[model samples]
Target: MEAAFRYREREGDLKAPYEHTEGPYPLGRWLSEQRRTFRAGQMDGERAAELEGLGIVWDTADAAFETNLAAARAYYRLHGTLAAPRGAAILDVQVGQWLTNVRRPGGLGQDPVRAERRAAALAAVDPDWNPAVLGWTVDWQRHYAYLAQLLDEGARLRAVTAGVTRHGEDIGRWLVTQRRDWARLNPEQQARLTALGVTPARVVRARQAPAKKRSTTTSGRGAAAFEAGVQALAQYLAREGGGTPGRSHVERLPDGSEHRTGVWLANQRQRRDRLDTGQLEALAGLGVPWAAS
Candidate 1:
């Protein structure tokens, strides 16, 4: 036991796999701890390389914005209300403020809708990359509230029309006709109805706003585009007046906001292999490689 304690002093017990909760989150915790050590000037060159090889940063950062939204959504479900960012709670104020600041206009801020869609697209591309999901869950209470009001109106109308032989077919037909109305709805109204499970089906699905500039990563072309983007950037950077890409970049979010990140970050190799989808496309647009040899 004494020897074990001494050995633990020299090397921590974190090398083993964690029990119970096992996924990217635990791994992300380890990665973050190692990063803290590196930041505090504790990691040597080889150790740093090993940590880099784990590819934790690339995955975490790529998923970070959306994952935070997912966790927040999960919080709302368990807690029975939207916390700080979305809700008007005092307890969740600091937390909510932090969330707002984190996903502010400059860089990757919290956007659950876009995150979910991108995650869905990623899952469509490769199911293995599926992260913790918080989906478009329904609020039956709101649906009931709306339905109750409508039903009351129906009752009043029926009482007035009792002299005539009338059926509720008109109401039923109107309700189902909402399917046609769904497509005509603006995005927010459709979203509200969707949340209430009252949205109707339509032949035409709303189209996503196109990216102002073409992004190869979002495009369906697979490895070929990635390799070509890498080659393109390499060629562009090698030409003249090109700098290794700033970690900060201009990104267009789903809300039609063009956000430019304020902070510059390290160029982790794993990022190229993982998070490089959007970044590479941005670089390709600017006609330069992110990192040139």
Candidate 2:
């Protein structure tokens, strides 16, 4: 297990909290002593910090991350497949592995967003092929789809179940994410799936559904007022805070009217969480920066 995996440093400097802990905060200048401290993404921050600031000097963060990956890699090695059992609730396991960026020394790491892709690829392959490489087009995280090298079209599969799985919301649902993918299915197949409330159109709508409605605080507003409120929030973000307001951060002006920008900025500073890509893009469209804290 140790031979197949080793810790690799993703970066040189450590980030905040663990960035410069002098055995404590503020006077953490002693962090430089561990020059090779492995950079751990925000997976298990407290443990990562302890590993770096306490014992395990060199490659501390990477060691912690790699050690965890060893277990998952063992499963993959034994199965020659990364697929979990039919009822193992596979996505949950994938989420845990991805949180720490687990990977082989030079191999691609797990990504939560791409769980579906990996799952689909695994579904595309035949159970007979184990540990086969160089098949699918899943880029680096190729956990499945490795097949025989023979050049025979007779062994090919016709539109196997790549996206659809017997899972929640997706249970009996087609894997066709976009409406166009429906072309792969014949009219009989389409009708059979639709009868079970699992059609390509339904899948697209489910995936594109908007988030749950806002809290009761804003539930009274009509559609027109909702648009106005969003526009006002955007303009305020552009003018005052320079960033978008989050659920926690928000404030009221001197006149007593709640100002979304002011409060969002305040809360953002109080809780130093990073904004995701989608959030940053939305703020960019409004001429506001993505600065959270």
Top candidate by TM-score: 1
lDDT string, candidate 2, 1-293, tens digits: 11111111322334322222232243222332333343434336565565544334454444333333333444445434443232221212442234222121112324543443333333343232111122111111122112111112233322324542221223112233313345443454456445433446534344566655432322344433333434455444322323345655444433455545545544434432343333433433444443412
lDDT (Cα atoms) of all candidates against the true structure: 0.39, 0.34
Query: Measured by C-alpha RMSD in angstroms, how accurate is candidate 1?
Result: 19.4
What TM-score does candidate 2 get on C-alpha atoms?
0.22
Candidate 1 residues lying further than 4 Å off, grouped into runs, are 1-20, 23-25, 58-73, 76-95, 102-104, 107-293
- How do the residues 7-39 of candidate 1 rate in per-residue lDDT, one tens digit apiece? 234455322221112333454345445656776
lDDT, candidate 2, equals 0.34
Clash statistics: count for each candidate: 3, 6
Model 2 CA deviation exceeding 4 Å by range: 1-58, 78-174, 178-293
List the pairs of residues colliding in candidate 2: 22-28, 249-263, 249-264, 250-263, 250-264, 251-263
